[model samples]
Target: MGISKKTIRLYASAKAVITQYLYLPGSHRLNNVIKRIDKLGNSEVESGIEKVMRAFAGRHRNIEQTFLNHFSRIADQNKSSLEYFSLQKKILLGAFFTKEYSIEAAALFNPSIVPHPDQQGLKADEQRFIMSLRATGEGHISSIVFQTGIIDNMANITLDNSTGYFTPLKKRLDTSYNKLFISKRAATIPEFNRSILDNLPESFSAAEASHILNSIKPTEPSIIDSVMVFEKIMDNNYELESSSHVPLNEKVIFPISNAESMGMEDARFVKFHDGEQYCYYGTYTAYNGKHIQTHLIETTNFDVFKIRALYGAAVADKGMALFPEKVNGKYAMISRQGGEKINIMFSENLYFWKDFQILMEPRYPWEFLQVGNCGSPIKTTKGWLLLTHGVGAMRTYVISAILLDLHDPTRIVGRLDKPLIEADENEREGYVPNVVYTCGFMLHGNHLIIPYAVSDSATAFATIGLDEILRDMKL
Candidate 1:
């Protein structure tokens, strides 16, 4: 996933190589050799001179006095040798400890911290994918590369100096198999723009920002495979503006159906000029009344796809399976994709990884294989409610709802708090485990028809009044 080498030579310089050496068994002996060299530099010559002086001294008593006075300058030499040995020992110790610390610190990738099988499938969230690791406790996400293909490209390179030739990691786009994947527009994402120049000073000019932004690849790859655009039709709580099919237009429909008892409420919808008439299912909650339980609304993906791509309702692969387009229409379900149920408001199938090999990512915590379809949905005002489900990796599932624009659903016109109900802990821990899924839903008056699959095997459901959901899914 990086650049090539030869072009690196043509680009610029590489980071300097710093030698990080380890202390070996013979290091102490090496220290001894240095000690001998010190002796040769300071002691041998002085000793030889002292021998000559003693020989030259005349009588035995004079010789004794001369020996005492000369002393072979041994005092100074002895002190220097001791200091040298102390310094040398310190140096050797420093090297040994430094290497030892590095060895210990580098063990983070050892199997204990990361325990997952090697598999390829998307997780709950739709980004930063994880790949199957070389099990045996290595890590969850690690890969090796063997193929390289690219034409001319400029990149930073390293040099040997003597030869000005550059070596580069000329990483390039997938200009292979007739693919020239590229994004021509400058990145508009504030964080991305910020990340590009994050280290730059405030004085940096827009030109500099432009340079950094354009230097790297601009488009991030899309991971999920379906999309839907919901168009709402309500102006407020009235039906006056909803007859139109345009979503997020300058116009809006009114939420004409009002439930006065709910202290506060939220309802959202999506109505596009091109959309066919569709039903809206909401997950509702009632705060002031005794109807404390919450519920989900059911709707179809065909309406979702009318205005957007098929996979707009995305999850972090682990939370929800990709709404497969291969199945299309009714088949694009969370649990019962393409199947029919005798009842419109109950559930029978809950979805899961099934076998870790079904998707394009690995299962990990950050990428914990499954999460819920929590993004509020696109709906018409009457159909303008957003519904979401929350799933614990092993213990619980809650369904929540809110209301969006009758046409422009992003307005997030409404939201719900206090999830209606959470699944039972005992019911949530099987192999395929405690789960809740809603791919299809509908609305009939104040009732939200939600058929959900639980824990991977059986499907069941409960009901919440429309007024309950309208107030809770706020913001």
Candidate 2:
């Protein structure tokens, strides 16, 4: 009735040494600060710049250049011209507006594992893996960070040391939006007018949409509310990318859009093959401090990412996981739209889905509360193995497993009546008590590598024999 428990290894959490500097608005009266900088003497400006360079040169790359970039952004806000200020003075002024942020100050958990694309110089039994984690910083905001390592022949885990530097992704301003999708969403708003969207192209940028909205002269006060809604929708659908020089582990996918202003939670990453090429795709929940929405993140090299909003009636709730490949010539996904039962959905298009069917429900006492998929299903020789989470008494969360027919995934073949892994004494004492969760897992050799969160605070790893778990399944 119970599976054997194995050893679990704890990883380092929230290293203060790794930090990213952000450009912040210094004071309420920014114009006065700029004016004061313009009056500084030549020697004073040179001395200030020298001091800042000496203090922060070791902490970041090209400190002076970063300061200049910040200064240029701040100068754009000033009413007066920055032509009078010297280069040194501008750089010095930029230092005052820059602030250091610790990316993982709060916690690091909810890990997802995928095989590294570049797998060279590895032993016969060793496979390289890229691990993505949820790094919570100040203000309880969550960002996606990564780590790289290998699983040896003996099933021992070895993680590479991080460079102690984190780079946030830059928003790609040229990202376009679909006019049809926008029109459909706009119809739900009471004050939105269909005529205002007439002349727009099939695809357009945020700026284009804003210009169209501004040109309309509505006779009612509710038009202001409609304008606000239009702006928010544009903000939710944007793109972000990181520099090529930044390593995979050093890149941080922080929330840039208003829809995810609060946090980007529990990304379920799967390395998918679409017949011609392979790409990495992740489904995550975006929280805007008030409401939650579903988002899809795409990346091939892990250096750059394209994030977009997922639209559909079935994508209304959290815990959405996509299969690694299409089933019956259509893309398939697992979701819990009702928040209690597991549902399967298929779509010809990746972004929009409208069809769904009930897959499973709470039958066992331990899962009477609710159930959801843990990550994307792992295809095996037996069937499509799906890892799931079930909530029970005291609001405790536990991981379980189920098997589905290979060709017809909608047909359930077998299930595990008992929990595979549960929180132990040491794991049940963090931010949320009695919770052990994971976004995904990987299979290496004969072992299943599970990187799981401990009470929603930190991350750890555990390995289970693949054969043992398969033999223990109840058909």
Candidate 3:
């Protein structure tokens, strides 16, 4: 009944391509490369610079500025040696150290949608929205990328065209850290030296923390864990800002910390509301090749982001979706700590979590393997409408829905008797086949708009009546 009553439309123009590239600096053999570049005579250097600019400048925005920025990454001693050279020669040297990396060459999927912060110029039924997706490039490294679009009254999605040039964000290390907070978060580490942390001032700078951590001369193997813990925590926290001239869609949040050295996967972004103030919060899994942890991200606008690691037992698994507002004066999160069932937790502190209650389990054949929330729950007059995904036999993934009481979300109200949506014949083939997934979705007017991944390779959209879904859910 559910499958026959609804029709899903796929946008043919909404797919990621391999042409977009980020201007990344290559640091391998830097000293040798600089020496070789210095050996070039004036005429050779000038001619080479001109040729490089002519062929490559058109492909990037502010190519010369990017080259200069890459040049600044070289050691001060190397910069002093190059001071005698002309500006053109220096720029050419920077170009030699830079390479282009396509941010989405492999796949772009798992998108979550939130209303755009600036919604000034829209018609009565037109809502502008921001969508974040996981862009996988070379090395299978995944990063968060954005797309802006508008949903009309008819429930059609029109994605903004790319500016043709994608640029990476400029990362700034957080200048300060709270010593007590750091110690508390790191307390779970077996060899963490709380004594050293106790001696530090209440507040400290990153340099101070590093100095203290480095000064420890380990007498045993366990002490090394203290240093490693400090370093990883320091690396996990940082701020990212986009170039003023870069469009939202062109700015990419690549991995900058050791905690997510491998990738940042499946960011579930929600427009969080507190009192009269509002900001965006996202929970994503940070993978450093060997281990995984949940990280919390905060931003008022899409241009700037503050990312930090989430601590405590409830965050041990991936797919932690924050509710739009606090539940009974505490922040609420839906998580899958055990990887088999959907669980819910509340926290007084946003960065830490300790307790959770089982919210749902695998009840049917389609979800006999596991179940998880597809994104943040959407508040409705009836209840909190949550989109979910279930894994059945052959690890097949299908998107479904459930309802929770508004005041006390821990109480289940209604659930879907069958899958809301699953992979179609055509949608079931890509990077990871037989899977349909989404990090988040949004409710517009009477329609629920779902932007889902097709086999983990590309993204597509689906729209169904909110009333139809509520009616189908079993109470």
Candidate 4:
């Protein structure tokens, strides 16, 4: 297969990056590194370039960073480095480069030679990568490009409309491309084990569905700290589970906290465990009640705890809010002013109540004069566990956890000497950082399921062992 001028440019662009590392004088260590790039396998300068570029950063930082700056650049004012070209360049940068700074280092030089024959960025075949995304819904943004040459020039593009790249001339069929990268397309999709896409509204357009498909993926714009997370839902409610443990009462009713917004959105009961069902607590911003949680479904006999609501409720005159979780027939809680603590209270029976009316109080260590920030709680084998997120003067909230006695809830079984988990650059730099909040958790066999809202736009999940966390909770 003969390479077109455009492909040749992309190929050369990739090759130039390698020569600068091997042939260009630098720390002989950097030069020595390129030989390994050469020795890895047989190559026509072109294919060799791809192999070297892919492996360059994997082995070391110095060379990869040199090319990355261009990859990360939103605009190509410099127009002089291997990173300077199409989305494919950035794709390679993300796959090969390690530390973000490594890619940043590559930005130093403007790449002159095109990787292809005509020195263009992406070849047409590469452009097809974006086209495969099928839209199932709406409100999406995508990036696309078009080959609007003198109509006579048979030049190709790395990205395109039919193949899912960005273009300047708007065709009636092409979706709007901001190139600010607000749009999306599916990069990887497993062969269907049988995909069931329900709740598809008829009002949405094909372009809109494609845009949404892009959003629910591990895309470059959505990558956090260079790590991409593919969530089941790009943006939706937190996971709700009916307690796995069967409750004493078979008819436990969850009061609809946010009934108006949820009921209209197709809220219904989906059984998780044989007898476990999740209550979809929803909210309505159109009305003055956004914090309202409504019971969308009910499970006959189960054990589930509403974590955030445990703390959001204002105590009579405590001057601080407390959050509580009922675990193993015991209560685990944390307060805004108090650290990790719990107090099992005795309560009166309701029409079909299942929990003990245990009084829960703030269980903080005596070390801090001020109360600790409030956090979420979950049950663990070690004890009744809690993840507290307290606020500092900057209004910054951090995520942390500690454990309590499984039997007698008041006992301060263990406290995290320090916060076990906190915000990273991703959570800290977006709409809001220093804040990691979990509405609830799913105790799946051994792993603790934690789903958190990111900077408030999207949602993600993290898994940690129940026992490993207990190991860290030192008194």
Candidate 5:
């Protein structure tokens, strides 16, 4: 049996544009460029400052303040005393070193839906949702952006208009690491010395770890490897904050950690409950041009986030999604460690996972190449309804559904033999052709609300009856 696609009309939005600031790199070449601007005549400098502000002031919030911040960082080494007006001029000159980056200029796709934290203003049968999307910009660098919307009982979707201003978190919050976990991760590197971790407290800060690394003298040939590992560990664990004044849609979670300098791709967000309060957690892939790592993001109110690298053998690949709640009193996750088969993993700690059991494989011809979970499994009365993506001939990607035993999610109960959603004629054109992918989906009443990407270029929504999907599945 196959899932019947609904006939609802779909639309894409062009108004959800987020702007990011691209700062100039600190280098000898750039140093000379700034020096030449500093030597310009007063009249020239004033004229340049006015021109720059007139063009960019309307595009950003507090543009002058941002320029001043950048100037202070770049000119801190200057020993020359200057007047307030001169400093302002210098700040304006530094503004030339910055450019506004439209984060979603290239593509906006791979969306995940979660229930909004505050849902007080909605009508009956109307539920508020917070959708996280992968906003790809120049160079295909993806950052996490958001859209707030509502889904009515009839399965109609409406996305809120974007704030037009994008603000990356300016400051990182200091985070502490578990001494045991750090030591264990260090042992994985062949060049690392376990003794370096000795005598440290159970929990330590980044500075404390760096200080310990500095005390060691490296005479081994793998010294570079050891240093790289240390830096990677420090870079992967950090915190970020956005201003409260910024709208949720305006705030962007850009790549801050060195491990994810390339991009943060496909965030699968789930509203997790720990028997008391609900917290949102996302498992996303972090790419650094050459290598990929899995990272975990946690936030209670979506304003502040704590992103850290996932550790252990099972956290090695992309498409790792956590169960919305604990199973059998342990944290559960769905992962694809071998790149083809879906595996279920349980962990005592959220950041670390070492054990896994094979749950599903490519059983149908439509998924002969590979299969992965679309998002966290949605729990239903019948079972755990899991939306999955499958790759077939010509590298086409399609969405399908399966049911897993609620108590033991590893046991498959029912599955759809035919594709549920595939790339249509109009949707087959984009950055990457013939692909329909989604990091997550949400269930509203009797409808399955799917916000998916078309050929990796733009995002659109679809809806299907949950009962119809279940009835068509084969056990």
Candidate 6:
């Protein structure tokens, strides 16, 4: 288990914190806030806006436009037309409705790494990467955030500084909905009437779905309840786009759906290579406080993301990681259903996983409490290199490795007898103590770079020679 002290260096400056702010409406008092703003004198409105812009305008892009947009949203919610208002009044009123939220004020942890889409300026041995972390704020609500960095030939890591402005994704309303998919999903609910969706075409737009739902007669309370669920289903599976002009590090994938309103936790992103096409897919757990579901996020250039719910029986539970590529002509995934043992599943459809088989169980003391894959399985010359997290005494979390037969990944090849990374004294205190975990890892020029979270409070990087890990793994 010996690894050279010179080989591993923790990048302390790589820690991620909340530098971005989101605009949210004032809770419960929105109606009152609007009424009070309407009563403000013209001179008072102008002076208030002037002071507010001087204090906050420099921190964001298009501050005036954001305010106007917020005002428009408030107007729409109150079912009012866009009445003519002085520009100064709009700015002042928008400030009243808006509040700043520090998105990652509480904790930032459980990061996953993937090769960046663009690597134009790098040297022959250098690789650019995008690391996604779960950022939790005031309510312990988590969202996905990014950091871009580069690893040179010498395995030295340098992360890019944040752009100092947070740009949230603009949800696209034009995204289409699938009728058959909704019908199948809704069938699981006993109150849902399949015939209600039978009239819609195979593929329809959101507006069309709304029309159909409104046209239905809600003669019974059960029917009304079922209609609400159907509308929520459509809303849950939608698309979002980032401003192309914004830096990748400043863009965030926040919780946008009721299914993920509680948080989007631990996204394991992988660049899947299928034939000549390369698409990035991240599987994350979507929690709505009362229920948890598996969701898939797909992006090709990182500018736009398409999110949808994963289906079938095996889709239950959290920490589901998709393989980088197909295995034996079928998509593969690593899942932990009951949170006790590691399991593997294969399916032809990326969204539907109907079955799973026990892949690995805790065989050593470090992981005797439970075991789960850290992220996606990494393809390597030796085999499919998989990183795992094992929970032991005191609920202590440690990172370990498992090697699977490349062609037949269900077959075990080698596994590390000891954890590759564990919390030392310096890393043992934070929001959660005695824990070291990651959502993914990447291989760069024979060096396996693992971006992990320390005590579920901050992030740090650890690198080790690929050969050193492969040599010590027990077959």
Index of the highest-lDDT prediction: 6
In candidate 5, residue 165 scores what lDDT?
Answer: 72
Instruction: Residues 1-106, candidate 6: write the lDDT tens digits.
Output: 5432223222322223322223345544666776777788998888898898898777777778878887777777674553766777777777766666667778
| TM-score, per-candidate, Cα-based | 0.25, 0.90, 0.91, 0.32, 0.90, 0.92
* lDDT per residue as tens, model 4, 134-168: 01011121111111111111222222222211111
Q: Ten consecutive residues with minimal summed lDDT in candidate 6?
A: 5-14
Best by TM-score: 6
**lDDT of the structure predicted as candidate 4:** 0.31
Q: What are the per-residue Cα lDDT tens digits for candidate 2 across 127-220?
A: 9999889888788888888889998987788988878677677888777887687777676455775655565777888888788778878777
Any runs in candidate 6 off by more than 4 Å, and if so which?
A: 1-31, 79-82, 187-192, 219-226
Report the C-alpha lDDT of model 1 over 381-429, residue by residue, as the tens digit: 4535645554444445565554534433224465454455454664464
Residue-wise C-alpha lDDT for candidate 3, range 1-475, written one tens digit per residue: 3333224332222233222222334544677777888899989988998898898787777888877766766535353556775677678877886776766777888999999998898888999999999988878888888899998998877888877666777676556678766877787566787666754677877778788768777777666777778777877877775455678987778887888988999999999999999999989999999999899888998877888898877778889999999989999999998899999999999998989999999999999999999999999999999999999998899999999999999989999989988998988888799999999999899989889998987788888889999998897
Q: What lDDT score belongs to each candidate, Candidate 1 first?
A: 0.27, 0.82, 0.83, 0.31, 0.81, 0.84
Q: What is the lDDT of residue 255 in candidate 6?
A: 89
- Model 5 off-target regions past 4 Å? 1-28, 76-85, 171-173, 176-181, 184-191, 198-228
Error of 6 at 464 (Å): 1.2
Off by over 4 Å in 4: 1-346, 350-377
Lowest lDDT 10-mer window, candidate 5?
Answer: 8-17
**Residue 16's C-alpha lDDT in candidate 5?**
37
Sort every candidate by TM-score, greatest first: 6, 3, 5, 2, 4, 1
How does candidate 5 fare on TM-score? Answer: 0.90
Error of 2 at 73 (Å): 2.2
What are the candidates' C-alpha RMSDs? 28.8, 2.9, 3.4, 24.7, 3.0, 3.0
